[model samples]
Target: MSYSEILSFVQFIHYFTIIIFLTFNITNVLSIYEVGVDYHAFGTNFTETAFLTQYHISNVRSIVLVQLQGIADRGANFVTLDIWFGSEPGKITDEHWLATFPMSAQETTNLNQYAADVASIQSKIDDHRLHLNIALFWLGIADYKIGNLTEGFGSDYLNASEFTARIEKTTDCIITAISNIRCSDGTLLVQTVYLEAEVMIGAKPNQDWFISTHYPRFLNQITVAGFTPAIYFLVDAREEYILDKDYIDPQYPALNGHRCMYWVYRSLNFLKIHQLPFPKRIDFSCYIDRNTSTYANLTYHILNDADAALSVLDAPKSYGIAETYYFIDDTQRKEFGQAFALEALSNPRLSHIRFWTTPDAGGKGIHIAYPFAIEDFLPPLKKISIN
Candidate 1:
């Protein structure tokens, strides 16, 4: 029989086995609020388990942690698996790349090093009992070790056709990597692959076809491959509250005929130059051939306090502050923390609020010295005196 037939038969048998297993032993697979720190917490002094244990806030912290063996122990069960697939340097191939998994599919002479990198993550999680809900894959951030479609090389493609072929391979590699990295139960340790579907971190590519079509296709392939594609939206609502619009809220600066507010007239409601037609996107079912709604469910990451101001209730599925340290003092943190935690508790959907050691991020000194203030970044509200 052909490989395709064999694979299909194997998949059928696998499904049948699963059905038989479930038929005999049935239980709920519902996921709970995997609330905890990200991979950065491992080495950084941002949040230590002691903080949760030592400083007990209101009842809001009830679900924060009950006990702690480490960052991933007990109540703090969530952790991040930030892997670099370009570890193999230049061993690019359709089947396997030793640089990543190291003889991942073949007999390795260097058995000790084979997949030792990724294997270590699995070992750590198993030891500490962590649940990985995000893939902060530091793509294109490391050294110039690869020349493939992934990492920092994809956007270099001249056109959509070229980008399609290149990104499909990257997606294939990503799929393989996700499949390879599993927990002791033989399930995916890393959920929600951070498919940028836009320019990856530091991947400054020509926006021509990359954004227009290349990225759209990339995310589509990811969904079709039986993975729930995810992207992050770092939104700040402080400006919105002050100006009644966030930059991305189709109002600030203005797009699709949005009103640009310049310090709010301090009072006047900005006006849109033109009211554009609503754009319709492809349905979720079209990608994977399943019955679904026209609504878009997304996962969001709020890195700073500015990001936390937005209404996460809209993205009820998954949304939370990943790493927020802009609080001026302990008072600010306590006040803001309590309010944020309280709101998160009410939201049945879930809000990922991470509390690390508190020294590096929340303790000692934390300020918004990000080199550019929000107002400074805004386009100069030009004056033209049309009278």
Candidate 2:
């Protein structure tokens, strides 16, 4: 019959098999802390085994990975087939390009293969090992080896209409491929798609084109038909993080790691700002330094601190939840306010701890953290005017 009909039939068979295979449980999938790190623990090259290892060490309920038509090609071809669950290991060979540019109905076979690939991935996530998030493509980054000036080169390098079309096709295929995936705990596992737009570390010509020119257009073009909006959020869209050395790739500013506090914190801030109106999640690629092996250790430490913070029941309540606070560490404390803030944040008893430094403190590496219990020990005070 038709390609869509064939895909539907294949999905029907897959669903039938799952119904026969898995025992239905009545428990609810509880709200899980979605702290996650991308599948970059294996250096420049990515592998499933390495992803599993990183997942375990991260102590997070979610793991992030990408399925490409090809990473280095113009059609944006890169696929993950080897470690997919419910399939023979290495049964479907990896492909560089799922479909060529100027796509046609003949590409239906490619679409079917892509759908199957996503189905396999969903199966693995349904095992409840960890939630899976797929980063569609690195927007704004260019690969010279990929396409021509007319086609606009690689993933983010494409012209507006071309990029949107490609993303629409890819997103549609992935969403259609994986149907409702229920975890053993009975929680529905909807795949999270990350619409990535970021600024890179070092300078490259036309890198900012996607960010400045295309991304705004993208916001309009992206459509969440089957998936929930809560299942998505922007990654590394803030400009300050891109320029900050502390949060960037050592070799290239664009590639970020766990050390890039802004990478996660910014998304968190966005969520807070937007109040997370829809289903949304973001995954971080953490690196302690520039080394790959340190990902697990670094992620563990951060999560451990977060876990500890969650246990606190009583912390001094402060006003101005949105207002900035300054932590003034006059104590020749070597670690200073940063250390002080870290200690307080890690304490389960304390939440809403934000720190800032005044011009005077900034000069001396000291900071002023506020909303502390000044009422308990001090007398009534009069307000002072700067003038």
The local distance difference test score of each candidate is 0.33, 0.31
Q: lDDT tens digits, residues 68-165, model 1?
A: 23333223445443233333334444321112321133222122221222233322333535545433222331212233334333223123344345
> After TM-score superposition, what is the CA distance of residue 181 in candidate 2 from its true location, in Å?
4.6
Clash number for model 2? 24
Best of the candidates, lDDT: 1
- lDDT per residue (tens digit) for residues 203-297 in model 2: 33443343333333333333333433222222232223322334443432223433333333333333334433222222232112213323223
lDDT minimum window of 10 residues, candidate 1: 281-290
Give the local distance difference test score of model 1.
Answer: 0.33
